[model samples]
Target chain A: MSTGYHVAVVGATGAVGTKMIEMLERTTLPISKMTLLASKRSAGKTLVFNNQSIVIEELTADSFEGVDIALFSAGGGISKVYAPEAVKRGAVVIDNTSHFRMDPEVPLVVPEVNAHALAQHKGIIANPNCSTIQMMVALEPIRQKVGLKRLIVSTYQAVSGAGAKALAELAQESADLLAGKQPEELSPAILPAGSDKKHYPIAFNALPQIDVFAEDDYTYEEWKMINETKKIMEDDTIQVAATCVRIPVFSGHSESVYIETAEHADVAAVKQWINDAPGAVLEDDPSQQIYPQALNSVGKTETFVGRIRKDLDVANGLHLWVVSDNLLKGAAWNSVQIAEALHQQGLVHV
Target chain B: MSTGYHVAVVGATGAVGTKMIEMLERTTLPISKMTLLASKRSAGKTLVFNNQSIVIEELTADSFEGVDIALFSAGGGISKVYAPEAVKRGAVVIDNTSHFRMDPEVPLVVPEVNAHALAQHKGIIANPNCSTIQMMVALEPIRQKVGLKRLIVSTYQAVSGAGAKALAELAQESADLLAGKQPEELSPAILPAGSDKKHYPIAFNALPQIDVFAEDDYTYEEWKMINETKKIMEDDTIQVAATCVRIPVFSGHSESVYIETAEHADVAAVKQWINDAPGAVLEDDPSQQIYPQALNSVGKTETFVGRIRKDLDVANGLHLWVVSDNLLKGAAWNSVQIAEALHQQGLVHV
Candidate 1:
């Protein structure tokens, strides 16, 4: 009677919950029942998945009893308390966190840019922001073929997107600054963030803070890349701006965006609409010294644009260099590509 | 009897010619006779400076006889073959080499944004790109308290701006990827652009190619930060755009930038015009996470500026981070502050 569906993940020993259990074991999610949950200090920890190891259990509020599809990457205070107790146990949740991403009834999805707002999910959705879901999958095929109207990113982030103790404090402050120590003699406590109260030395360094000083002084990871890029490009009058930082990368996430195209968009039709969009790749070719690279986009779930060009003075300006994989397409392969777009839109029922 | 101006340096043991012999031994000029030069395999090496050692020698065509100011950081093919043989033997060169920075009779200079374009020098002046001399000393005090319009930068450069063997190949490919080795079993060669024919691994990576694929596909360090910020702010209609990446920092460079003022410039008067500008340095205080980082602007020669804000949507936009020390204010303390502003504007003659 194992006819798939009944899945869950909720921070199963994180770093984007072990890449959402290795993207639900190579997705096409049929799952039948996995459950892993966490905290209570990663409960009896086990975690394998497909070949089944599982264990981890401790999350409460009845840990989504008969879950149909959960996910939630465990922090936005455990998805603002168990993502409504895994949507009051009917499950659907998705949520990677930035607390229900600008919650207008949540739905900040990015299944390659708004998977039809996941059927207007009332059981929560939100996952944008691993630098705004790789700049909305490298700018939703140039905002659906030239009409973006303004943007300006700058990231280059990575230190495993600030998790797993910021990748063990960037490998113990890069082996204590290559063994000669002194970044004020080591002991960093974790990233330009880990509850930001001042903790620097992102080994070899460059941390124009990532997520603390909000409002006018940006960085709540630059207002979640300027408000989850206007709610996943649903267009809040299209203008945006960001500046993230946090270098000494350990797992891809390189931006440097910059857009603005209400019309006239050429660089070969925006590199043939980012090589015909959908999860973007087009690692452009500046004559063979190809482009897009942050340790070659880590475990890549694709979003690797390249130094596209145009913009010598804003005639519909441009310029890219995207890159991806900050814990798989910036957080558990975009929450298992939004649970494979809600099990291919039947919106999962279990 | 030695009275004060003979100087020289040329490529005196590289890395911005040993920081222009440690900025001609703590600058207030008055050198009298130093010399050095290099390349004939670092001609008999030696170095030291004030505590006296010297030696170097070889760069011939008669090494500038009565040298008066010289400087020139080796390579732009040894400053197009010995900077006009040290400017026809009388020597006033300066050069740092982007091969006579846009030579419409070369002026370029950035002594805190055009030390009066060094009284229009003909005897070779030019220094500018070390990421465009710390972004023309952090945007020439907000382009003179707000009258500039449109600009966009990105850079985060450093791998010792591809020198000192790209900082010993990013400290031997970051101790060969922390001793496990794999960026394709490492052997990077140089960097994103060490004469660009492919050489990656900027350790722990991020290399949106700098310096080598000019025009349309950008990168010649993004058209030297878009044509040396329009020739050191002698404004060619002030609209620019750049990207230039290369990370794994070994010496500061950072940038981010983005500007657009011709008026309404707030953010505490752009942090009090970059804290009353003259070589810039305001390290913004987003509630004391104090911005401008890049290993705290290594060996700082000013140009710090912090994350001044605004532009949540244009209204004369703004946003800066800028940092410096791309070998001291981007290349031997801006070529020893343009030979201390050509020895305080008397345009240095011997």
Candidate 2:
């Protein structure tokens, strides 16, 4: 535990990977060396760390040879191909993709919610969905105080979560629209789902679909939140439904979550629990018009919870608004937190 | 009923008023004459109606002297001050403001959901909130097939609903942000809520508060939706909860609505009812990726309902995605529809 560890960050040129490096720089984990891996297109690119320029390498099977911890965030395909190779090379791969999330052997980890589940991971731990991660940060504290029975969430997700290209698309499309050009004439190559054949403008419009549509008409993004929350909470009995939407926001993801607890929980008590929890901030002062704003949560690693109130008609129902930087707490910071937890428990091997 | 009518469009220079004029041209109502009325500042402006230019006149107590039906799209203050005067001058005011919506004398109408409510109006008929109108169009059909018990909605509203200045602010601030300038440096004079001291950029963000804050910490926009839904349905006991958010969308309003019906209902039955409803267009075939989108419904008057599905856990619970042009069906068209209803029923006096 005292020795320095070797870490490798996959997708180093991407949004979440860049934040992972930043989070690592502020962490107490003694990093002996850091390796940046990306596609061949981005290989040989230089990124600064500790005042020195380190070149990103093209990822391959041998990339994880001496790495103790590997954070994979390229995409589901890359993770499916390289994660096993990383694991075989003795690195504990923490995948930030949906590829291995539902694989029973892979434990979906949201450190605040289910860090203990990390002990059961077989060389690879899966990061929960961005929308799910933020909700878990806000709900776990309350769930611990009073059990959760049912949940409904509607997310206002950001384009940056789709990657750098989508963010650029929004900027360009917005500029074109303001210039009086037809929005349709402006090519949409990045969103609402990049891999989906047709793209829609995200500049001043909301795309209700996030990720690809799955069976039962639920998008993969919504299914991730539903399934990941259950796996992270280890409660298959909890009823969960999600409507994940892509808004024009560039960074933070905001959610309006309604929950019915097993026990009737008072708003004040739940607010107190959220305030007392680590990595959770309470911004629910209605009198002062204080509530979480996506604009304010950018670059931050904590989940901002606000607008906590009991339902007027349903005795056990409570509603809350949760906001957090999807690239940070929802991805990079959460991945780094898992590595930290694993290191503290002496679970990582070189 | 067969004869042409003399229609007066109050607040003719405003957002909804302008749209009302456009809708009237496309509507089945035969207009013998069209009068455009506005405040002193907007007087002398010319608007074309049916290939003829009509000069805008300053609205006064005597403005409605020869008007058969007056469609009001002015603010609540102007509606309160001038609606009675218009009624006294032999015109029936179809008001698109909240000033008279909850009044015992004024019937809150969504033409599709409660056109019959218009028959109860003495002299003025009130239009429901933009968010409520869209939801009611999607849900009333379900309510008819299977009685509605509770409704929970979270809205992704557009900036145009706030007025022209707010839309301009959003555009200006967006341009500032693209130039790498701070949003605060742009000086937001109107947004989130115009009367509120603080304003946030809606360029790429979602503001949870739409109107001014009301009792129970809900925004006035949220309260208006809740109260207006009950009054329009004439069911005080039906539970409704709303979370209204202002997104960067310019025109269309989108909502994620969850409902519980008194009787057990399947997705197919619900879809059929919505498809057959007067103003509702079902866009919900999930397999082909056919679903309601805000961009598609921007200038359209139809309320698009899609993603209708039964909840996995609750037998009576259903989820729907509703979208409509906030200025059209939610305001202008509804106002004009009331005018048409009034003229047909002999409620208007020329």
- State TM-scores per candidate: 0.40, 0.97
Q: Which predicted model would earn the best TM-score? A: 2
> What are the per-residue Cα lDDT tens digits for candidate 2 across A1-350?
35688999999989989989998987888899999999999999899877779999999999999999999999999999999999999999999988999999988998888889888888999998899999999999988988999999999999889999999999999999989987678899889888887688888888888988988889999889888889989999999988889998888999999899999898889999999998999999866668898888998999999988777778898889999999999999999999999998788873
The number of clashing residue pairs in each candidate reads 5, 0
DockQ leader: 2
Tens digits of lDDT, candidate 1, A14-117: 78888888877888867788888888887986978878787988989798988888888878887897888778888888888788788798788888777898
**C-alpha lDDT of residue A150 in model 2:** 94
| CAPRI-style quality class for the chain A–B interface of candidate 1 | acceptable
TM-score of chain B of 2: 0.97
The lDDT for every candidate, in the order shown, is 0.82, 0.88
Per-residue lDDT value at A66 in model 1: 88
